[model samples]
Target: MIGYWIIFSATTGNEFSYLTKHFLFNFNNVEDIFYRNYGKRAFIMMKIYSFLLTLPLALLACIPVRAGVYEPDKLRVYLKMDKRVLYSDEDVVLQICIKNVSEKKNFFDVFDSIKNKPGEYTTFQPLVYDYSGREAEITVPYKLEKRDIKELIRDLERRMVELAPGEVFIHSINLKHIYKLDLNTRYRVKSLFYPTIGEDIVITSDNELSFKIIAEKRYNKPSEREAVQRNISPSEVILLTLRAEKDKNWDNYLKYIDVEKFINAYPEYTQKYLRANFEEKNQIEKDFIKYLTRDRDDYLLHYKIMEEEIENSKRIAYVNVIEDRYGSRWNYRYRCRYMLEQYKDMWLIVDEVATVMQGAKR
Candidate 1:
């Protein structure tokens, strides 16, 4: 009689050890039976024994093998908005909450320190879909081209913060200040939070947040007159233009500016160049406005209209803008001179130039 043996390694913690088993059977009478039946019965018995011996091993192969115990996910994310419906001009405050659901402390970049260089940090990239299933355009506050890559990397490296187990971190962002949403439209905003820059672990909310923007109440009702008219001065035009620029209303900005006169004054500036430059300037205006509106200890002291001169249809205004940013870390001021011309009872800005009175830290 011949014996069969089987060996397999059982997986243990970072090590492998083998276990062997043997099966023994007796066929001492098999020689006499083979001579009686011409070995036919012996061949059938051998095949049956071989199959019976290997059946258990074949069934064991189908069992799942586990090298380690299962662990729960480490992070959980949540997205919240103050109001589901709001006016188009109103700001939508988005709150992002990240909670560490694991037992051990986790290290992650909170993304609070890299506002000017958003590309360097993992962010809650948002996707907004309109009612028609079309994606809307969302503009970020800071652009990659505005910051140096090395500086951004340094900021990110130094900004890594720690979150304890079961602790939550919350961050709020103003959607109106950063993005342009359309009026009278419903949008679905979905966001995914990436805790680390180089890792693949991303946490997202179970469901998306929905919001609607309706037209302003004032604009909903019809008026008796064709249009409401208000008489604005040359100085008022400059202020209104600045306000429009701060609001990121590019169309309203061009409304107050005489593009034809601006182009004629600066022949080197083609229409395309003028439009592009206006958009760039609008972006700068958004940044400065954000700084002014920030919830910080610093404050804007005051701004003064230095001088205003009107000659025939042409007018020039000089203004001084100052702010006490971060308690004298740098003197923030701008000396701006605006040129305007009277057009159809409205003062239209023709051109302007500004010089930084004081430069900040590089």
Candidate 2:
């Protein structure tokens, strides 16, 4: 019986002292201040007997107790991230959820470290923030036991401290731990039990907060070498006409074709137009046969020859070409950038602009 009381007190942190005395102790031995008197005896003979006679009745205290069964408090600690995903330099929000299983209110302070003594419970606070700046600390209101209400408060301060400006940041949260309600009998009897626990729940987040650089333009090369080192391929430039012909997009076709290159290359047609406009003699008839039958292969070679002749006159050439001969008008201009590469070996030209000029005089 003494062992049973000892275990009960230990389990409840010695709070069962009243229950032990009133229910488990001998009623006759109790001296209520007003009722201090000799206990009633079954008989005069038994009364004279030693204390050992009542000792047997103490055995009744060992009746296995079944009163409030010791069930673990259903404690669930979890971390919840806000629905909005924050970008780099943006604020992050973390929510803390605490549940109490007891049928009373509980007060607890959630902190990163443990308190040294009984009075340090109220000294801890969590930091929080919004995207603009430092927000506020999250506080758990009076948590009612038995009935659990979910309280969502942002822990912005903790998140900001973990991530620095422009750091390779990944936002992940840990629940850390949980502390529950433990009754402090030294305080008010009405407040016999309060939330007394340690960190048990670790809250973590899978998605990280990141930011996108709004002003930066993403291209293949860096900014400094943009002008002198610009790469121009016939394939890239010729796409203007090919795409226009394929999708029949006249706007792009007109916008992209190289008019100057066409007139310079097709001298027979250019001379005929010049003669009609300036009353000079025309040379179109003399070159008519070659112009009509010239395929991409012949025309490209002639163009290469003309470019070389011009470079020869200038005394310098950036590129050289043996010939500019190509297959056909369509295939010749199809992404002519590649053709320019073959021609760039011996010819000097700006880019692979379109060879055919739309609406040009014959």
Candidate 3:
């Protein structure tokens, strides 16, 4: 009782005023009010009551702040999944973000900067389930043939990085390529991740990663998207490019054409791009897409890849294209000589020389 009086008297000066100002109610002077309302005994008791009310905040302030904190709300793992409606024509990309929201640095070896899915090279292990929580079917048989994890670790040792506080390392997985998803059914995907990949450190994904594959495109006819593939033949690349444009599937249409390469092929655009700033360069790429799609009259009607020639440095595709537009009363066909080069896993149209086919039909 004597100890309580000492604590209550000592706290009633500044701390009592703070607590009352922020938490309860503000007064000119709490000690004067309490003393005036009652004698010293009642005054002491009321001060003790106020002190008890603010005890938790006082105790929390006494706890020392520490570095390397790994709270769920602080440290995070989550998917940056995107779809303009999956199964439409876009890749089912599950971009994983491993972030360090601490005061100190964090290191993770779970994956390289890029990956198709979690595996020996990719490291994290994933579980995919259907809408009913049943294990999803691996529609396309996945061949997990690769070197051991030890070898991958040895090879990637030099390239690993430490994520500084407030930094995130991201990598993506194409779920559609990994699991066979039924149209309109939701799918849940999660991964077992060890930041160190072998031993102890843990970072958990706080969000439930889920998405659905909806067949928004008409199912009665064949989808050209099926032909939109990685590592496609040069002829297929040319064929899909024209077809994607005709169907107005912007993602696949631009997929086969490397916009940077296509835009820079023209000397004027190339010089302008080199002199332009970052924001302007992005505008130039958008201009390329706009130039292709802005006029419906320029849309391709029918295109046949006539020939594909392969040389040591580059590949060339000759396409005979039929052009028609409601805007044009009568227009003929075209012959486009497309120049392509190997870009990552597939071919992209880098350049094209088109000449109107004078004798061809409208």
Residue 220, candidate 3: how far off, in angstroms? 14
Question: Can you rank all candidates by lDDT, best first?
Answer: 3, 1, 2
Comparing 1 and 2 on lDDT, the stronger one = 1
Candidate 1's TM-score reads: 0.37
Q: What is the lDDT of candidate 2?
A: 0.32
lDDT of 3 by residue, 241-296 (tens): 87877788878888888787788666767888888899999998787678766657
Model 3, 346: alpha-carbon shift in Å? 20
TM-score of 2: 0.20
lDDT of 2 by residue, 1-362 (tens): 34333334553534456545654456543333112222243223333453455577778787764323222243233344553333322333334344444343323333232232212112122233334453323223322222221112122111111112222222233111112112211110000111232233322222223221122234546448555646543334353344443454555544543333333455546655554532232344334323533342333322232222223344223322222334444323211321222243232232332343222122
TM-score against native, each model: 0.37, 0.20, 0.36
* CA deviation > 4 Å runs, candidate 1: 1-72, 112-121, 141-158, 217-362
lDDT per residue (tens digit) for residues 1-362 in model 1: 22112211322423222112111122454334333433566556755666887788889999976433212257677788989989765677777777777777766654445455554224666667887899776565343246533345455534555677788887777766556788878888767776654456666765689898887656455565746666786767766666655555666767787655555444444444456666775664454345434555533343556667777534443333332233456646667677777777778877666666775652
Of candidate 2, the 10-residue stretch with the lowest lDDT total is 185-194
Worst 10 residues of 1 by lDDT: 15-24
Error (Å) of candidate 3 at residue 327 is: 56
lDDT of every predicted structure (CA atoms): 0.59, 0.32, 0.64
Which residue runs of candidate 2 sit more than 4 Å off their true CA positions? 1-230, 233-257, 272-318, 324-362
Task: State the lDDT at 296 in candidate 3.
Answer: 71
